[model samples]
Target: MESAETNTVSQDPKKQASYNTVETMEEVNDSPVEEVRLTVAITDDPTLPCLTFRTWVLGVISCAALAFLNQFFVYRQNALSVSSVSAQILVLPLGKLMAATLPTKAITIPGTKWSFTMNPGPFNLKEHCLITIFANAGVTGVYAVNIITIVKAFYHRRIDPVAAMLLTHSTQLLGYGWAGIFRKFLVDSPYMWWPANLVQVSLFRALHEVEVRPKGGLTRLQFFTAVSVSSFCYYIIPNYLFPSITALSFVCWIWKDSVTAQQIGGGIRGLGLGSIALDWSTIAAFVGSPLATPGFAILNMLVGFILIVYVVVPIAYWNNFYNAKRFPIVSSHVFDATGAPYNTSLILTGKSFEFNREGYDSYSKVNLSIFFVLIYGLSFAVLASTVSHVALFHGRTIWQQTKASFNDKFGDVHTRLMRKNYEAVPQWWFHGLLMVVLAVSMLACEGFGRQLQLPYWGVALAMALAFVFTLPVGVIAATTNQPAGLNVISEMIIGYMYPGKPLANVVFKTYGTISMSQAITFLSDFKLGHYMKIPPKSMFLVQLVGTVITSLVSFGTAWWLLTSIDYICDQSRLPPGSPWTCPGDDVFYSASIIWGVVGPLRMFGKLGLYPGMNYFFLFGLAAPLPVWYFARKYPDRKWISCINVPIILSGTMGMPVAKAVNSVSWFTVGIIFNWVVYRRFKAWWARHNYILSAGLDVGVAFMGTLCYFALQYYNIAGPSWWGLNIDDHCPLAKCPTAPGIQVGQCPVH
Candidate 1:
């Protein structure tokens, strides 16, 4: 007569085993009720110093280096943002090296009860974690920099440095408050595994845990080193000497002047159907590492990518949707209907800087490629569908956990261990931080009105939207490793409210999207700390200090780049084949025009050009209903429940900066690692999959950073042969060859 949950709990026998011996959560769930325990042990070891001198020194250096690297890569033609996992991998050797050699003497502070040691007892795991957290903050790339780049580089507008710094700092820190509040629901629950963190956890355990040398297999460290050296060496070819090898489309080579060949084989300009990328950066650029992503999620994303990039985009462009034939099929650059680059400066009133109707009419209406139009439509669908998907799948579990968190009655072993051993960060601290950031935000908003024309109320509304969306978005991110972005929704709202004011729209979107994203990122780190059994108070301090450091270092680096590099972002000023094209900034500038200057009322209204795109929001809202119903009705069909509509749509989000080769390469590697090896060689895959990914990422980043500074910055040319510099191997690939199109140069066969 007992319920299913009760009966299962009563029957399981291995549930009482010590958590350290438990290999997986599935084993814990199979065990008996009385023996139920977490898969990891909990301890309250006060002797370990997390904020030691060594920790600070190493953390600050890593943060500065990563911040510089992230900002540098953001401006590249083929943008490649490095992950914090690079820091996570690189710091292990440095931490150990520091532990081995740093003076062990304690430095007594002038204040009471605050003596610190340089060695900090073997550079303990807690200090290691804190340093990584510091690096993570900076490496996550400050989203607010996009606003500065668009205004300064593309719009040719000047912003006060002080105001810009304040804006960046406020938006980055505002998310921490929400992250603190959502800790109970997102961080405490064991089910919220934060899939990406598992890779870190696995690496940490491998690094710290003692193991007898096993025969016939490489140890984790051995495998990591082997892969790192090989990857680091191999990257030199694709990243520098033979950059064209990164995107080699055989079809284009065979038929030089064929439009079909260009569409299918051009890695940078087309769908990249037959292209093969040898570079790790190109492979992992858009979709992330194959080993880390789950097989099912990869499949879902692949389905979306194939349908949109291969089928929908070609059809729309061929049919001349919104005169798509007049422009390149895949470009981030904004253009007028006449196929000329959009000149917003010409259309703006000289005195007030408002959109001038006379100039606008003479300049002609703006145009978007069919692919760009699809991106906006799919983005709206993703925004609405994510909420509905989460509500249907995780609503009940979230409700139960919320009740338990409030009652302080922890059911999960992980939660029990956390509560028993760690001092929870005081709620007042988070609330106080939130209030301070909000006040600073108001001042920054006033500065925006003076400098950028964004009204103060729009700033407040942006914060409100961020607050409302944070929890739902956090839920999705924690569970799926894919965070639903607030970029599209925020831009739509602010664009309509502040029509004809491009700066104001971007400012509002920055606060709204960055706040929500930063919160989710902070929460993910919290979950990582939880998995490692790091103290909550230490985690809180590290995040707070890291965010501040990131703002200063990232903004400073960006400003320095903008000032020092002559015509860095302007393609005509820089030498040909230069990598600094600011592709992302171009996209950001285009969005500002499409959503802000023109406004959605005129672009997607009843009488607008692309009115059909407006219904995408409704389509998003309703798409998940039937799927959720089917999932509930047939719960046994596991694959049915794995269909994540949002993650699927996310495949197209990177279209502006990524080509089809990235996705194709990502899926191929993912299939090899997650599906093939995972199923056939379970033990080997489990032991080395994450280690391999971490190694590749670290190697590529380290080498890429070195090359950029050593050679690229000095303008030293690598042998300029066709083989080495493939930048112009397929020039006609970028040409628009639809009927009667005479825009770009197409080769005559």
Candidate 2:
């Protein structure tokens, strides 16, 4: 994988330097996994300067820009993750132009002999990966800010700015602490290949690698440019012109008058049978590009999705399990016993915001659709399955890696190269940082007038849960590109232990889940660094700086919008077509009410309407046993090991927030590319598969941003017509099946 370049000391300040090394200069990348060999290039230019003047300038600029834009769009309806792909593509020319134009002069430290130059050699892939790392930091909007947003905007409570900053820093940096501790297991080992980073690696190489045009086919760069333009042009129709095409449920069109048909076929609210999405955002926005995911993982996810949505949910709903007939078949919203929308105001204790037992006793109990309840149940199952699955499949490898990492005796060439070239991050650094962050987090909850309401023990419990789940979940994510989240589990635990404290529950969730998520994200970035051969010290510094800047920018943007805008999140008061409806926060607000204000005790406990959901935890604990047993029983069959129960249990992970169409389309697309095309057109799939995913992602992102700022921002909507809105044309899907139930515009059942 080495490029046609000479290795020498770079005395010239305008060129990168490299040292002589012994490597098997094979025609292919040397790796244990086939995907890594096909995708990531195993090359290194150790002397290439990573932290140059342009890196800091562009890194900060990209971080601030991404943080601001992501925070801005998060409140809007149908928010998609504005990924670092947008920046990875846009930053190449800016960095090169800076390198080509800036004067090559060395600046001396005032009182020391140290000197550095602005244009230290050419703009290399290492610099680009670092900048993208910054973008990664900003792209993930501060999760703790959700706690702040729900507190101020939804709960109408005051929170100190200092406390808010503490919350943000503690959660994100706590994850960084975990990342430092787990680097040997997650980053140093070759087995933990993060599937998501393949897209980034492919895109960076396609943009930077010098390639001659083949006889008749387009090069990687040519393919990416063409697809990006085409995807950009094609997105307007679905994004603005005809939003209905995003989810095409033809069954609803065929039988428009039948409630049962709509309930089974509606793409947004129901099972999404035979539905397809023409829009890339509709497909990739929720679960990511199927092209980037492995075929086995997708198959496993499909199994779970089918078992739950196609099998269990229909049976439960039709039979009126937990009074499912009182509400819509599948919905994100909770309801009262009579099927009216559940209002948090009716069950609150006024300013104290605690659950009122008297008020609750007088009102109807909270109810959820069968599908929503199953999602929670499956989440518990996934958590349990993740632990068992990893123990069965990856436990021995992890133990070996842990021991070998102590002596720096990694077997892979990539880790060997990194060890010989760059210094490793010390274990004590991570340990010290973890202690500091843990202390700060405890103070954030305990201080601030006890406004957060979470006790010190709550923080300890959250940390313990995250610690227990982090390694297993990290292994799942590294291999499958999907990790079952801790949000529901943490919420359930906190709710049961300390009920009726909305602020407390959300804070606990943010701390517990976001920290582990952040750790995995950082570990993924570290893996990217390993593949790109960037310095470990440089990657560490870049991540820390980027996280600090992103937290500030994201929090500042959210606070400004909340304070300055009148009726920003209030949908009723705002005019039509307003993008400030705070759709994502609205869901967060609902969760706070369900888990915090009302508490799970009133919803799923003994006194609650549905305690059967608790049994799912035990079910999840046992879900992986059969799969593991069979894999062991049939040692020659390779496919049995890939039957991931955790992935299956978490198959419908994006429901309600993502809609059924998103998951269905993702499965459909993933199968066609990873399973079908991969086996047939091996060469083309190897060269352009991840590139196509990147182009479609950035294309839709740019076009959507353009449409929002140029047109939708000023209240200028598309033409008034049937195709102008997100009308899935399945109104009957909202109807309940039990006899004599009246609600909304649905026909009487």
The best candidate by TM-score is 2
lDDT of 1 by residue, 578-651 (tens): 78788778778788888777777766765346778878888888888887889889989988988888888787
Candidate lDDT values, in order: 0.76, 0.85
**Positional deviation of residue 467's Cα in model 1 after best superposition, in angstroms:** 1.6
- For candidate 2, what is the TM-score? 0.96
Cα RMSD (Å) per model?
A: 5.5, 2.4
Task: Kindly give the stretch of ten consecutive residues in candidate 2 with the minimal lDDT sum.
Answer: 1-10
Return the top candidate by lDDT: 2
Over 4 Å off in model 2, which ranges? 1-18, 22-30, 111-113
Off by over 4 Å in 1: 1-47, 78-80, 111-113, 726-728, 747-749
What is the lDDT for 400 in model 1? 91
Clashes per model (N, Cα, C within 3 A): 4, 0
